[model samples]
Target: MYQVRVLVLCGAHPLYTNWTAPRSTFTSLLPRAKDRHWSLLLHQGLPLNNMAIFAKAPTTCVSFLLPGPVIIQTDEASSEVLYPNYQNCWSLREKTRGRKKAAILQPGISKDLEKVKAGVGINSSDEVDFFVLLDNVAAEQVHSLLSCPALKRFAQMIEQRAVDTALYMLQEEDREGIQMAVGPFLHLLEGNLLKAADPTTPSGKTRKLYLYATHDVTLMPILMALGIFDHKWPPFAADLTMELYQHQESKEWFVQLYYHGEEQVPRGCPDKLCPLDKFLNTMSLYAVSPEKYHMLCSQAQTMELGE
Candidate 1:
């Protein structure tokens, strides 16, 4: 029996930087599981950034790559946990570092903002699926603030103009970077696997596969675009996690996402997002079957977000 192991590292922005470095705790943790053939999945840009950091390391480290095939995918979700009420001077001051210029807005931009506000609404689910929703109070506060006409208008404008521009640039950069780093590894594995299997004779036997993803919060939008996550709602802290197991009794893989840590609302909060670490540890041990694994790979292939 092939014992499949899936490990996920979850946290906010900076933690990703740590994982990509040679001397970081993430590297140290790798050896502990080295005995088993491993695969990696980064939820957002974490894996991409980590790879860049690894390349810069002075000492050559072979441990970063697994003996088997490694697959990397990028997830694009927003990292903004606390949506402040830009309409309120005090709130705006706090969030903008008391800079009047930062808080002030132009008229044309404000008009476009109203259109954006009209386009989106808050999520009203009682039991939220991810960790970021844990802070009910904070979530509510943000909701209330965002509901304001002025702030909503401004947010919409920013989303269309500034936010979209930056996200597009980052997404392209990350996608290209991950492909360059792992492309060769993927080709090698695919070639070897194809040769091992007899093409002339159709065999019913299925192979066990391991997979991983690395990505960033912006991954949420990409996921939604690719039809992986249907809910139009943005991802939250606890929402970021890794899903692992088998598909169709033949294939195995992992899906991951990243969210801001502060977005995790505790259970008592009105929104009720779970804790990050607890959620991940729970899912890591979940069971998997070959049929289910095959199904997962099929869906993943259809998603077409990963190269």
Candidate 2:
């Protein structure tokens, strides 16, 4: 029986850098934030931010990804016990998959900020700073601060504006934005899919599951590239899964996507599980080969140096 192959890609756990609070304030708030929420998610009483927490209980990252309460007993020391449910996983060292394109993408955000300033009721730089502070707080703890209906509405507006600005620069405003942000990931994903479809080829080693640990920067772009981004800030430990299925009789491969847990239909595909060819065609708009990626990065760097 040939079981369906699955690819699970997800962002990392909450990190110090994920917070937008000032450095001085962050020193205090980080601990409080952890004490309030993150403490419950800890594994075996281990401290928050412990890298070994994931190593010991891989499924403790978040609620949706948690298959069950993985109990790792120190007495039963085995690889299977430590890392359950998966056989093979690879970590791409170059975590900044599209760092070169980030510069090209950043300039458009100023335009996004300009577009939203009026809507946000910000007339001055100080007001802009206030708006940002409020937005960050709302994102982290909306219910805690925003108790009044009017205040909650304002907070929602601020949060929406922030989310929209990020999404606009990533996908909504221009096609190139999506292309630049997702090109590297698309290239890797397409190559992997193609290889997994073939069995005879030397490089085509079939693996039942593939997991990619990444950050929101990588997750948002891939989602936007696939035309399924929900336009909200991706939460910590958010996952996007791509499942490849082979028909029992015909043996043709098909692709289906899930974000967090909800099934998603790709941009132009008719249904949830789309034919691999059509899926590749939809992805072709953003895939950047290594050679093209290098050339673009070089050009960008040269232009920046010249300027």
Candidate 3:
């Protein structure tokens, strides 16, 4: 059998049924795994849940939501510490073009979006208005709307486009976009891959699985950084898994990425199973070293906030 290490990036709050339901099903399948770690790393806004599967599992204190380390100016001089600044490339995107309707969307799509907004009692003409309205829509109301096949299809399309707008704003060409969006997390993921490939490391020898629980905002940027985002709203419990394998004979290492359950061929890879060196090189484009990450974040100026 191929020796493998698994890493799962979960992007959803467990409080929602949508997140909990699929999580339950996924956990049930691995009831007997011997070497696994489930880290409930979360943003400050999310309430921590220590019960359930995490009751006995250790958790990471690091919040992977930000780029890590903040530089502050004191009365005496300047200092750098671990903290969050809301002025990241991802957050600054709100001040850019994400909130406005893109010129490229077809007129028919615009009409459909307007109809979706109206159905949900949204009076605003903003392109992203429906997302705000839909968040508060009662589950029963959504169920009733989805009961009709046409309405269900329309709902899917609108939701996907709304999420796509958010993704589009994080394009690599944007100022420090990929760096501010996923620098720390990308660095950590690269470290994991490195450790998994080495047999003498503690994590490589003992840990077989690693899980990170986060939100859609964090997940989308990661997907975009990896060049695998499908431009769809990540439904409840959406996850990305990275599997690293070592051949038994030649002992060569390879990587495979999966979104939800479907295998993905990440950009810069020639095949579904990518050699470790090639995968690392592709990811290096988005990865930032600790010193550089802190410097870039310290230089950021806050932009206007919005959806």
CA lDDT, every model vs. true structure: 0.31, 0.51, 0.55
What candidate 1 gets wrong by more than 4 Å, as runs, is: 1-148, 171-174, 177-241, 247-307
Compute each candidate's TM-score over C-alphas. Answer: 0.23, 0.54, 0.61
lDDT of 1 at 226: 24
Q: Which candidate tops lDDT?
A: 3
lDDT score at residue 45, model 1, on the 0-100 scale: 26
Structure candidate 2, residue pairs in collision: none
Sort order, TM-score high to low: 3, 2, 1
Q: Model 3, 38-88: lDDT tens per residue? A: 322222222221111311222223223323333433441122111112344
Q: Which lDDT value does model 2 have at 238?
A: 53
Note the clash tally of each candidate: 48, 0, 0
RMSD of 2: 14.4
User: What is the per-residue lDDT of model 2 for residues 1-307, given as tens digits with 9 covering 90 to 100?
Assistant: 2222232323233332332222232234336542333223221122121121212212223333333343444342211111110121111112122432342245654454444554445553433422353444443441232233433445545545556555544445445445444566677788878888876757536654554545555666677778887877666335577888989999999999888657999988899999998899888887876565445435645665799
Q: Weakest 10 consecutive residues, lDDT, candidate 3?
A: 76-85
Best candidate per TM-score, number?
3
Clashing pairs in 3: none
Alpha-carbon RMSD, each predicted model: 18.6, 14.4, 11.1
Cα lDDT for residue 77, candidate 2 = 24
Candidate 1 lowest-lDDT run of ten: 49-58
